[model samples]
Structures are given as C-alpha cells and as structure tokens.
Target: MIELKSAGELDAMRLAGKVVATALRAVAAGAAVGTSLRELDEIAAGVLADAGARSSFLHYQPGGAPSPFPAVLCTSVNDAVVHGIPNGYRLRDGDLLSIDFGAEVDGWHGDAATSFVVGTADQRDLDLIAVTERALAAGIDAARPGNRLGDIGHAIGGIGRAAGYGLLADHGGHGIGRAMHEPPSVPNEGVAGKGLRLRPGMVLAIEPMLVAGGGDSYRPAEDGWTLCTFDGSRAAHAEHTVAVTSDGPRVLTTE
Candidate 1:
C-alpha cells in the first residue's frame, strides 16, 4: 500500500537523501578516464559508512535470478542501462557511465542516479544525458499535491519521446519512504492526468532511463542484474528522490 509519511519520517528521509547525494557527487567527481568501476564502488561504500548510514542496494535481491547484489554502487556504462554491477572495467573516453546509489538512514531510504560522459562525448551521447536530465526535472515539477501519478510519468517520458530516444518500459520509478522500493510505481511512460492522486508527504524516487537507438527492449546480463539495450545503443539514466509538498515538490536529494 502507498503510505504517507509524517513530518518526522520525512526528516529522516531527508538525512538519508543527503548521504546519497553526497556520495554520488564524490563518485561522479572521481569517475575519470581509467578509473576502475570497483574503485568507485569502494569510494561510495566508505562514504556511506562514514555517514553512519547503510546501503539500500548492497546485497539487495529483488526477485531476480541468483544471489543478492554484491556492490553498493551501480556502474552502468555505455549500453548498460541500470543495475550495472561494479567490476574491474576501467573508464574510457566516450563512455556513458551511469551511477545509481541508494542509502538508508534510520530505516528511511534515499535513491538517486546520474549519467556522466568520461573524457569526451559524442553528440548523440550528450543529447541522451541532457534529455534524461531534463526529463527528471519535468517529473519533479509534476509531482505536486494535486497531480496524478501519470502526470509525473508523462512529463518524464514525453521529453525522451520528443528527443527521439527510446524509453525503457520495464524499469521505472517508485514510491520511496522507509523502504528502497515502495508502492505507487512511477513509470517513465504514461498518460497525463491519469493514475493515483498525489498527496502531501508522499516521497518518490523518479528515474528516467532512455536508449539512443529509439528501441526500448533490453536484455539481462549474465550476472542476472545489469540490464542492457538490445540494440547495443548507448543509454542514460537520471533520478532524484522527491516529496510532494503543499508549496511544491520538495527534492530531498541535494548537496
């Protein structure tokens, strides 16, 4: 069931959000050419531990194939869309690296992700990331108290469609409060003015994943976690944990 958070609960989520945002910032900064993906995961793990928070993603299993996830940070590069496990692969020029991180504080969860182009980037790659970033902003704007869940999804998905990119349908956003994955699944594509009604104190993690080749299909990696585009096209993902507020959408993931 979708649950409304109290002010106290919102405050706890805010703290967790900060931890995630800070860690993501540090990881992105260190994602230079030649940096190992595993190294970035270690950096994020230390940051979460130092903040006295725990990873919402580490060792997490969500009705998948094998065991729990091994890494705290998701290092999705190039055609890899989401849940890209960190490994010994090193960053390279023109690589579209998407890092997704989640942290828990006092049981509340914060989740966010960002895509970065290592060294240099191609025009198509830059456009993918830019559109995904703008899509996230559109979703946040639509997460108002009176808006329906479809409004948020429509806003996000519309941008990718306008950009001629393919929106991943299977994996979308979700309501996030005490748990990493909660009720009110937030899709990247939907009709506006449809779906559940938004209420104040409802926290959600809105993420938009897009593929450059105008195809939405994806295949699971052999690791049983990472999802990559079927057409071998580059992809980008952007996300933020936000709260529906009376004044407006309160973005909890910030510096």
Candidate 2:
C-alpha cells in the first residue's frame, strides 16, 4: 500500500535525507585515484555512525538473494552498473564511480546515489555523467502533486534517448519512507499518462542508470552482488529522494 506521510513524518524523513546527502558528499570528496572501494565504504559507514543513523542497506536481504548486503554503500565502478559491493580494488585514473547509500533517522528512510569521475576523466565519460544527472533533475522536476508517475519517467527517458544512451530498465527507483523500498515502482521509461498519480505527501526516489553502449543487458559478478554491463561499456547512475507537496516537488536529499 502507498502510505502518505504526514507533515511530521516528512520532517523526520528530511533528517534521514540530510544524512544520506552528507554521506554521499563526504564519500565523493574522499574518492580519488588509488582509493580503494572498501575505503569509500568505510567512510560512509563512519559518517552514518557519527550521525547516529542506521543504514538501510546493511545486512539487508531481499527476496531471491543468497545473503544480506554487507556494506553501508553500493560502489559501482566503470562497467559495474549497480549493487557493486565495496572491496579491496583500488580505483584507477579515468575510472567512473557510482556510490549509492541509504540511511534511517527517527524511523524514516532516505536513499540517494551519485556518479563521479576519479581523475582526468575522459570526455565521453564526463558527458555520460552529465546526461545522467540532468535526467535525474528532469525526473525530480516532474514529481509534483497531480502529475502522473509516467511524467517522471518520460522526463528522464527523453534525456537518455536524446543523448543516445542506453537506459537500464531492469532497475530504477522506488517509494521511500519508513522503509528503503516501498510501493509504486518508478521506472526510467514509461508512457506519459499511465501509472499512479502523484499526490501530496508521497515520497519517491528517482534514479536513472545509463550505459554508453547498446541497451542490451547485464550479469551478476562472481561476487554475487555487483552488476556489470554485458558489453563492457561504462555506466552512470544518479538518484534523489523527493516528496510531492501541495506547493511542488521538494528534494529531501539535497545538501
């Protein structure tokens, strides 16, 4: 069921959202060439700990999964798309990195993701990241009360299609509140007038994962968590948790 958050609940959710934003910012600032993905995870874990926040991803076991997630953040690098576990691998120059994290504060949850270039990024990689960020913004802008969920997807899809990037349809965003994932799945592509209608007090996470090659497919790595592009092309992902209000769409996970 779709739960509409009360004003008080939204305020508490904002606290969790702020923590997520802060953690992502700190993680991004600490990321650089030669930095290990495991180290990045540690940074995020520390931030959440310092804030006295609970991680929504830690030890989270979704259906069909062999085990629970073990990290505080999902670190996807280059060909790896999403759910990339942090490990001992050190980043190299020109590598693209995607960091996804979620936190719970005052019993509410927020999730966000960001993609960044390690060092001396390639122009094509930079462009891909820019496009993904722009697509996310477009989707967020479309998340006002009375707007259909398809409007959000259409806004994101238009940018991806115009740039000729491959949209990863398998994974997108979801409703976030007391739980990290909830009702009303938000896809990256859809018809403009279909799906659930947006309403005040509804919060959603809007994420767009784009690939530089064919929109073909991906596979799980031997690690059983990381998802990599089947064609070995670079990928980028961006996300934000937003709330539909009487006024407009408010982005809760902003610094």
Candidate 3:
C-alpha cells in the first residue's frame, strides 16, 4: 500500500532524513586516499549513534542477498555498482566511491546515496558523477503534484540515454517511509506520462544508476552484498528522498 505522510509524520521523516544526510556527509568527507572502507562505515555508524538514529542498512537482508548486511554503510568502489559491503578494502587515488546510506529515527526511515572520487579524479569519472547528480536533480524537479511517477524516471533515464550511458533500470528507486523500502517501484526508465499519479504526502526515493559501459548487467560479489559490473566498467549512483505536495514537491533529504 502507498502511505501518505501527515504533517506530524512529515516532520518525523524530516528528522530522520536529516540524520541520513548528516551521516552521508560525514562518510563522504571521510573518503580519502588510503582510507579503509571499514573506516568509512565506522564514521557513518558513529554519526548515527550520536544522533540517536539506527542504521536501516545494517542487518538488512532482502531476498537476493545471501545474508543480512553487517555494516552501517554500502561502500561501492569503482565497478562495484550498488549494495557494496564495507570491509577492510582501502581507498586509492582516482577511485570512484559510491556510498548508499539509510537511517531510522523515532521509527521513521530516511535514505540517500552519493558518488564521489577519493583523490585526483579522472576526467571520465568526473563526467560520470556529474551526469548522475544532474539526473537526480532532474528526477526531483519532476516530482510535483499531478505528475505521474513515470515522469520522474523518464526525466532521469533520458539524461543517461542521451549521454550514451548504461542504466540499471531493473533496480530503480522505491517508496520509503516507516520502512527502508516500500510500495510504488520507481523505475529509472519509463514513459513520461505513465505509472502512479503523484499526490501530496507521497514520499519516494528517486535514484539513478548509470554505467560508463554499454552493458547494464551486474553480479553479486563473493562478499554476499556488493553488486559489481559485469564488464568491469565504472558506475555512478545518486539519490534523494522527496515528497509530493499540494503545491509542488518537497525534498526532505538535503545536506
């Protein structure tokens, strides 16, 4: 069922969203050459602890996952697309890192993801990250009331197609509220005017996953959590949790 947030519930979501945003910022800021992925996970866990927030990703096991996620952060490095497990791997110069994080506060859930480079980034990697962020912004822009859910995906997918990037449309965004994932599967590629109609209080997480290579295929790594690209090409992912309002769209997660 698609649940709408009341004013008080929206306030609760914002509080949870702020915790996620702050933790993401902390994790991103700690992404440096020679920094271990485990270290980044620690940074996120520390932030959540201080804010009285609990990690939604930790111990979360979906159907496809081999086991419950053990860490607070999903640290995808380079060709590792999404759901990357944080481990003892150390960051290197020119490595592109994508951190997907979610947190819960007072029983409300907030989620977001960001992609960045560790040190001196390659121009190709820089362009990919920029494009992913723009796609996220475009999706958020189309979240106004009266718009269809497909419009959000259409706007995001168009950018990737125009740039000749491979999109992971199969694993797109989803509705998020009291739980980490919910109804209304928001695809990254769809007809602009199709899918569920947007309305006030309907909150959705819009994320765009783009790969530099032609293939969109990925596989689960041996770690039982990370998803890696089939051809070993780098990928970028960016996301924001937004709510449709009577007047327009209200973005709840922002730094």
Candidate 4:
C-alpha cells in the first residue's frame, strides 16, 4: 500500500534529507584523484555520525542482493552503474564517479545520488553527467498533483532519448518514507499520463541512470554487487527525494 506522509512526517523526512545532502556534499568534497572509494565512504559515515543519523545502506540486504551491504555509501565508477561497493580502488584523473547515499532520522528516510568526474574530466563524461542531471530535474519537475507517475518517467526518458543516451530499464526510483524502499516503483521511462495519479503528501526518490552506450544491458560484478554496463560504456546517475505538496513538488534532498 502507498502510505502517504502526513505534514509532520514530511517535516521529519526533510530533516533526514538534509543529513543525506550534507553527507553527499562531504563525500564529494573529499573525493580526489588519489582518494580511495573506501575513504570516501568513511567521510560519509562521519557526517552521519555527527548528525546523529543512521545510514540507510549499511548492512541493508534488500531482496536479490547477495549479502548485507557493507558500507554507508554506494560508489559507482565509470561503467559501474549502481550498487558499487566501496573498496580499495583509488580514484584517478578523468574517472567518472557516482555516489549514492541515504540517511534515517526520527524514523524518516531520505535518499539521493550524484555523479561527477574525479579530477580532469572528459567531454563525453561531462555530457553524460549533464544529461543525467537534466533527466533527474525533469523527473522532479513532473512530480506534482494532477500528474500521473508515468508523466515523470516520460519526462526523464525523453531527455535521455533526445540526447542519445540509454536509460537502465530494470532499475529506477521508489517511494521513500519510514523505509528506504516503499510502494509504487518509479521507472525512468514510461508513457506519459499512465500509471498512478500523483497526490499530495506522496514522497518519491526520483533517480535517473543513463548509459552512454545507447544500450540498457548491464552485468553484475564479481563481488555480487556493482552493476556495470554490458557495453563497457560509462554511466551517470542523479537523484532527489521529492514530496508532492499542495503547492507543487518540494525537493527534500537539497543543500
């Protein structure tokens, strides 16, 4: 069932979102060419500790995952699309990195992800990231009352298609509240005006994962996590936790 958030619950979710935003900022700041992915995860852990928030990723064993997730953040680099486990792999110049983080505060949960280059950036990588972020923005903008859930997906997928990028077909966003994953899966591509009708107090984590190879196929890494593009093409992911309000879409996961 889709459990809509009350006004007070939404306020609590905003607090969780702030913590998630702060951690992402800190992780991004500490991400340098020489830094290891594990080090970046530690930076996010510190942020959650200081904020008195709990990580929504650590030890999380969602269905289909091989084991409990072992880190506080998901660090996908280059071809790796999502669920990239933090490891000893060090960042290098021109490397594209995508970081996903989530936090829980006062029983509310918020999740978000961002992608960027480590040091010097390639034009192709920059373009991929730009398009992915644009797709995320479009998805958020469509998250308003009187609009259907598929409208948001159509908005997101349209941008990727027009840019000649391929969106991951299987993975997308979901409802977020007391749990990180809730009802009403939100796809990255859909027919506009189809699916669930948007309603006030509905909160969703709208994420867009785009691949530069113009294909949607992916493979799991040896670690039982870290999905990588099947065509060896780099990918970008962007996300925000947005709430549908009487006024419009209010993004909770922002700085």
Highest-TM-score candidate: 4
lDDT per residue as tens, model 2, 135-198: 9999999998888999999999999989998887588899999889998899898789888999
Error of 1 at 120 (Å): 1.3
TM-score of each: 0.98, 0.98, 0.98, 0.99
Candidate 3 lDDT score at position 164: 86
Clashes of each: 0, 0, 0, 0
Clashing residue pairs, candidate 2? none
Assess candidate 3 and give its lDDT.
Answer: 0.90
Quick one: best lDDT, which candidate? 4
Model 4: per-residue lDDT, tens digit, 167-211? 886999999999999988999999999999999999999999999
- lDDT score at residue 32, model 1, on the 0-100 scale: 93
On the 0 to 100 scale, the lDDT of residue 27 in model 4 is 95
Candidate 4: regions farther than 4 A off: none
After superposing all C-alphas onto the true structure, candidate 4 shows an RMSD in angstroms of 0.6
Q: What is the Å distance of residue 132 in model 2 from its true position?
A: 0.4
Q: Sort by lDDT, best first: what order?
A: 4, 1, 2, 3
- Clash pairs of candidate 1? none
Q: Which ten residues in a row have the lowest lDDT in candidate 2?
A: 214-223
Q: How would you encode candidate 3's per-residue C-alpha lDDT over 52-170 as one tens digit per residue?
A: 99999999988877789999899999999999889899999999999999989999999999999999989999999999999999999999888898899899989988898988747
Global local distance difference test of model 4: 0.95
